[model samples]
Structure formats: C-alpha cells, structure tokens
Target: MTIPGHDQSSYRLRLEWGPTGADAVRADYAVVVDVLSFTTTLSVAVERGIEVFPFRWRDARAAEHAMRHAATLAVGRFEALSRGDARHVSLSPASLAEVEGVERLVLPSPNGSSIAFALADAGSSVVGACLRNAAAVARWLAPRVADGASVVVVPAGERWYDDTLRPAAEDLWGAGAVLDALLHGLGVDAAASPEARLAIAAWRAADLPGDLLDCAGGRELSGAGFVADVEIAGQHDVSEVVPVLVGESFRDAATLPPDGPRLRRVGA
Candidate 1:
C-alpha cells in the first residue's frame, strides 16, 4: 500500500517519517532514525557486541518476550532504579554504555522501536541509524545502493501530549545525518528523492552539538535528567557499528561474513 503523492518512489533513495511514512516509501532497505535515544542506544549496544531486541512497548509482553529470548529486559528511566534492580538500563545511550555482562537486551520504545518493527514486518532489511554510526551505515549502504538497491530513511518522531506525531527536530537531524553521509560524505551515486535532499540539506546546514542540545528532544531528555544521552546523540561518526535487524534482533552488521549474510544461530 502506498500513499498517493507522498511516497517518494520515484527515486532510489528516499526519506520519510515514522511507520506510516515507511509504508508509503516502501524501499528495499529501511534505516530507522531516533537520535535522542533509540538508534543511539542501538549503536552502543551493537558496538558492545550485545544483541538488542526491539519491542514496541515496555509492558508485560516485553518482559515475557525477554524471558522467551533469554535476554535482559530494559526498563524506563527510573522504573528499574525505583525497583532497586541492579540492571538499570533505560533508553539512555549512557546507561547502555555503562552496562556490563549483558549479552542480549529487549528495548521497548514505542516511537523509534515501533517504527523499526513496522519496517521489519514489511520485509525491509532494517537497520537503526543515528548520528554516531551514520557514516558506517552509509558506507554499508553505498555498495548495495550502487548495485541498484533502494532505501528509505525513516525518522521516528516523538509523540505529542495528544498522542500525535511531533516530528521532533532531533530525529530530522538524525535522518539528515545519515543522508549527508550517504550523498556528500561517502559520495554514493544513489539518486535521492526530494524528501532525501531535504534531509541532506538539514544536516549540511546545521551547527551540530549546539543544535542537537537545543532541539526539543534534547531538552526533553535534559529535563528528565538524561542530558548525557542527548550529548551522546550530538556526536557524529564516532562508531563503525551498524545494527541490522535480522529475524527479531539488531546485530552488528560489520561482524557478519563478507557481503553480509546469516547472523549465526549456533547457540540453539
């Protein structure tokens, strides 16, 4: 199903927002962006060699899912803290960076994670993208796109008080960061749609670090005392890990065999 006039299907590279927008674009690969947290944390997890399971909600189902996978379930900012559980890792990238001995984790985030699930459900090869790993992700995609594959970068925006999409600035910048890396940074020959061009422009014209901290999502995280995570998001191209969703988990794509195939299932 495609949205008339909105789906950037005319171009090999496209950019959109959230799950609905992902459906509209419908590309071979989908890059999910959530700068303030989800993708940022995902990069850190993959960098640490931890498999991450993206769940849509942090509810009873998430806990059960984690148990079924024999993975640790991540809780909200203060939920695990209040419960006095030692494994207190939230969506914050900082929290995940400090964690140890965890091989697998279930990250339940409705916005970014939900969009990732939607894209995966639609059978697109999904990868989480943020400023930290944008260059690496772009490098991976460059060869594939040059070989005639298509891609859509989806910025998972935040929700408003009324539950509507807020089109958060941080997410836009994150998407733009990926686009910038692909087009100008890596010089990928993939033709970009207008939506994609907009993203590239946003990234090229931004002030960085300062712009990210002043964004709405940054302020929100800062107000919630997770300013460190926002600071982490402000960074650009510091990681080579690209977390690709294979089956149900996001694993480091760089670790796979040449040409990227089969995340090993030897444990089972």
Candidate 2:
C-alpha cells in the first residue's frame, strides 16, 4: 500500500462534497485535505498536542453535548457548530490552545470535519493533510503503503450556496505535487494543468517559508489573524506525528507501533 502516484495501478481518484459521502469512499490509506484552513488548523492543533474530535454536520448538537459533559473544548465553524443555537469555537487555531487538560475538541467545519467523518468511515486508516502539513504527510505516508492497499486523497472544498468548490484548487495542486515527488519520485508535471504548473513554479521558485505566506490559503489565514499558525503549519516535516482517527477520538499515528516486522514507522 504505497502512496498512490508511486504505483499507478494502486491509485484511484474520487470527488465528493462533505462528510455524508464518507460511506462511498473505499481505501486503506485516506488523506483528507481542507486547504482553506480546517484541516490545516486541525493538523496544527494535533501536532501541538491537542486532541481533535470530528462530528457530523447533523450531529453537531450531540457533539456539543458530549463536549460539555466531557469537559472538552469545542472547536468548529460558527455556522455548523450546533443544531439549535449552541455556539462552538471558530476554526482559528489561535483561538484554541497548546495546553494540557483541554480534553475533547468537538470540531464541525463546512469542509474539514465533514470530510473527516466521511473518510473515517470509508478508509481503513484516515490521516489529515493540508498545505501546512504537506511534507510531513508525505514523509509519514510514503512507506506506510502495504502490498496492495488502496489510498484516497479527499480535499475538503468550500461551499457556495448549496454547492461546494474543491478546497482551493491551489491546495490540491500543491499537495498533489508533494505526493508526486515523495511517492513517484517525479517532479510535478509542468504540463499537468496551467494552475498546477503555476503552483509548482511558485513552490520551486521561492523559499518554503516565504512561499507559504504568499499562497492563497496562507493569505486567507493571514487576513483572519492566524498567520502565525499558518507559518507553523507550513514548516515541512517538522513533526513526525501523523494524526489518525481512532473511534471517536483522534490520536497521533506515530504512537502506534508498526504491525508487521518488515516496515518500520519512520518519524516521531
């Protein structure tokens, strides 16, 4: 189950809207991307030692109830935070924390949690990925592939009215480029698409720290006062932690020892 692009025979692509589509996805390795910042923020929080709990769009109230009773902090979009009128934290990592004893973060985002729930159901193992955690995800995923395991990269896009747009196309382009590099050992195909080519050019031209500040998602976070988190998220391969959904809780994949004797987990 190596990364998809490395072996074309084990790769397949699928497009979906929100968490509801999780049932349709069937893969061993799942990569969920919400480039606008949901997945980005989640990765940052988890890497910082915060626990993330994803809730369905329809089950937000239940999530809030569980959060309150469990004394866990709730973090999610204001729109889908609750069913009746309950409030939940916004999707800003700055608003969250890097402290201990803050148990349970009930997260529901337009793109992030919805996609997360879906992937958790369909994927044998679901991992969160964003531009901020791109290199880390690639390094973590590269050698995790089993002999014939299937992998799916679900990019949580934004919604307009009732329709959703692919999480910034630039995110998908950038992530795809990284995956291509790690798994396939191939540089992004400049001929793939104009948008992809441009992203690759920008990625190669500028230093990572500088380029992250200028990317579309980076600018959005900067404008939202989360520029620092964006910077932290953009640091490549800084942490060896790969977040995985375990039941109702999320934990770092690095904590689990490798199952077989052959493949060893690489990063911390």
Candidate 3:
C-alpha cells in the first residue's frame, strides 16, 4: 500500500517509478513523465488548445470515451498512417504537429497514460510532463512547492514483453529534467527526497537531444520509423505550455483561471 520504509513524505519534491509507486508516495500533486511519447504528444496537444483525456488502454473503452466527449480517439502509430487522413492523430508527437479542427482527444497508452489516469482517479492533481517542457513545469511548480505543496513525480517506465517494468532511462531523464529545473532554476530550494535527487543526477548525466537519439527507446522508435517522435521528445525546455489535469482532461495551466480548484486525495 505504501513504500516499506523509504517514505519520502517530508520532502517537498519526490520521485517514484510507476502506478504503484505513485500511490505509495502519493502527494498533493503528481507529475507523470513518459518522454518517448505520451507527455511529448500531450505538450503538442495542449499547446494547440486541445483538451487531452488520458485513457489506460487503446481498446473499445477509448473509442467510447472519445465519443462521450465528442473528441477523436487516437489510434496506434502505424494505424494512423492507414487511416488515410493527414490529420489522424496517434501517440507519435510528430504526428500531431499539423492536427487541426479538433478540440478534445482521448490519448491512451499502457505506460504513462495509465499512470496519469490512475493518479487523477486517485484524486491527485496531475501534470503531464516530458523533456520538452520540463523547465516550464518546474517553474510552474516552484511557486506552489514553495507554498507547501508536496509533489510526487512519476516516471512511467516501459513494460517488457513479460509485462515487467523496464525502468527505461529516457523516462528517468524526463523526471530528472523536471527535478533538476525545480532544484536549480527558481531558487525554490524545496526539500527533495533521495530518490528525487537520483533523478536530478540522471538528468545532468544525460547528453540530451543527441544522447536520446541513441538511447534504447530512441533506437526502438527510430527503427520503427518513428524517429521524429523521439527527436521531438528529446528537445528540452522548448515549450512554455504546462499541461495540468483539470477534472479528466489536461489543459494548459496558463489558460485556466488563477483560482481554479485543485483536486486532492481524500485522506492523503
């Protein structure tokens, strides 16, 4: 139910691995990182004024969820090419570059999407993050973290063929990117857990934009003709948009009213 003895509760900034870790170290806020795509695509979508709904799967439920919101349901990367529509959206951040005439979209994946959905379901104010907007996310959180908001950053790692977590380095870098900005950027000096410090180190160790191209996840996507997506995900701090989950959809934090209500776990 919670971390055995590695509780990071006292720290204002924290880091965790997946859904279970998220629930274990549940805080007043959560940051979901999935740089190979999910959050990268989310950055693109939110920048375009599109509302994104995170779904745990890309099956029938996604279709129904999309329909219920009058939104388009994203298809698989390869499936999008076959859709014959130039605007067909997929998990590929590159594919969403030219999307138009759409407002709401159901974006789903087994990793980050599931994590974001679950964290929100558990009543944590969730923010979708990737390498591209790490600094901006950190800047947004700095003031709040200064005001006593505890954050649990979740790096949604990939799953292996046997369904075990792969602990992908890219996601660690993604989370580290945010933690690094928060610690070194605005002079907030929020208390960071040992786990969060590790992430910050990983972010510094990364070579960025170039190192990601050769990372395992990058090679996998490049080999599959989705290299552009990897490239987009690799760009650091290039976006000013911060996608915060409002109710069930991710909206640009800047666009919402300053006094908007925040979701909080019942007894957390």
Candidate 4:
C-alpha cells in the first residue's frame, strides 16, 4: 500500500498537509488538525456537548443539511453580525464556546471540513485534533495502534486567496503537538516521514503556546479581532475530549459507545 514517491515505512505515523495529503495516505486512523479555527472550534463544541458535522463548503445546501439534522448552520462572522444572529457566530472558537442548546452544528470550511469529509469518505477513522487536546488524542490513540496499523496526521492548512494550499504554521505546530505526544508517549516503533520529523522538531523547539499566538494564522485571525479565539486555540493540553468522526458528524470519542462500528480498524 505504498504511494509511488512516498516511502511505505513513513505511512506508519506520517504528517501531511491539506486535503491532498489526506488523500495520499491510507491509514487506520486520521487526526485532522486545523488549529486556526475549524478543528479548534470543533474541539470546543464537542467539549461543550455539541455534535459537529464537517461540510466541505458553505453552500445553499448547508442550510438544508442543518435542517435535516436539526442543527444550526454556522455563518461567517460578518454574516452572523449582519443577520443579527450573534448567538451562533461563524467558525470562531470563542463564539462557539458561548453557544448553548444546540445539539448539532454544520460547520463548513474549505480546509478542515474538506479534509474531514475526504478522510471520512475514504472510510478512515477520523478525529479532530487541536492544541487543546493533542496529548489527550495521543493517549486515546496510543493503544489503538495495533501491529501493522498506521496513523496519518493531516494538518489542514489554510487556502490562499487564489485557492492554493497555504502550509500554515499553526496547523503544523498543532499536528506537531499531537505528533510529539503520539511518538513519545506511545513509544510506538513507527516510521515518520520527513514532514513528520520536521513537525516534531518544530514542536520540540517551539514555545508551543506562545509560538501559536505569533503564527501567521494566529496573527491573521487576531488582526480580525478574534484575538480571544487565537488565545483559546493556543491553549495546550487542556481538553480531554477527543472529537471522533462517527456517522456523518464528530462526537466526543469517549462517548462513542463500544458496542457498534467502534473505531473500525483500517480496512476492517
């Protein structure tokens, strides 16, 4: 199961970027990191008991999907404000924290949600990973790495204005945060790709929480007056909830009762 140019060994515990990366690696488990907002927001929502559905984009069907699930369709910050719907703001992590009584949410993002949908469609066990729950995700996944199984960590990087992939530092560090825990804490003898190694090194060299604030994604979001969101996204290892993708949405991994379709092993 080796991709032509990619080393098969690296598939064990690899780190890759964007949706293309998620498509390239076939793993038993996938941890998607989009720290700037999508995943960070998902982490917060799941922590507050909200089930989040990752939609590839914000389209007309978004409203319909929300209606089908009896969930709220989150709008962009400006859209929310313009519509006088301040209660359920866009992808801002802080805004999501303040939301209540919403059992489900349809969260659309070009980066994070696209990757999530791609991985889920591929039948991979997907989990939303962020700085807040990196270590916890690792701990939850440690024992699941049975022999011959691989885990792919996809950092859902931002899209440039022109729609090209922008390898974001926030996502790299976020993936690295989880990589550090998975590799060290699990003590698994897994092969890591060059990108994976670089991520781990970056995490080791960085003042994680502080560096996250200064990353390009952080600065951009903070400049837009979501400074609190940036700060909230940078909080390290504070959340114990592992947002696992089950059915069409993400719920806390701990709550995914073990009786059925339990985190299916890759290809099982």
What shift in Å separates residue 8 of candidate 1 from its native position after superposition? Answer: 1.3
> RMSD, model 3, all Cα superposed?
1.5
Full-model lDDT, candidate 3: 0.87
Report the candidate with higher TM-score, 1 versus 2. 1
Candidate 2 — which residues are off by over 4 angstroms? Answer: 1-25, 57-59, 62-65, 68-71, 76-90, 97-100, 184-216, 260-268
Candidate 1 lDDT tens digits, 1-268:
6868787767888988887788777777889998878899999988999999998864678888999999998887667557766568777788899999999999988788888877677667888999999999999888888877788899999888898888977888888888888888888887899888888888888888998888877777788777888888888999999899988899998777676743222112
Q: Candidate 2, residues 186-250: lDDT per residue as tens digits?
A: 32222232332344454455556666678776786688556766666565545556677776656
Q: What tens-digit string does per-residue lDDT give for candidate 3 at 71-188?
A: 9998878788777676778988887887878889999988999999988887789998998899999988888888788888999998899988889899999999899888887777
Clashing pairs in 4: none
Q: Provide the overall lDDT of each model, using Cα atoms, as 2-decimal numbers.
A: 0.84, 0.56, 0.87, 0.83
CA RMSD for every model? 4.1, 7.1, 1.5, 2.1
**TM-score to true structure, per model:** 0.93, 0.68, 0.95, 0.93
> Where does model 4 exceed 4 Å of error?
1-3, 7-10, 81-84, 259-268
lDDT of 1 at 63: 85
Shift of residue 210 alpha carbon in model 4, Å: 2.8
Tens-digit per-residue lDDT, 34-122, candidate 4: 98889999999999999999887857788988899998988876566567666855888888888878888999987888789878887
Most lDDT-accurate candidate: 3
Q: What's the lDDT of the predicted structure labeled candidate 4?
A: 0.83
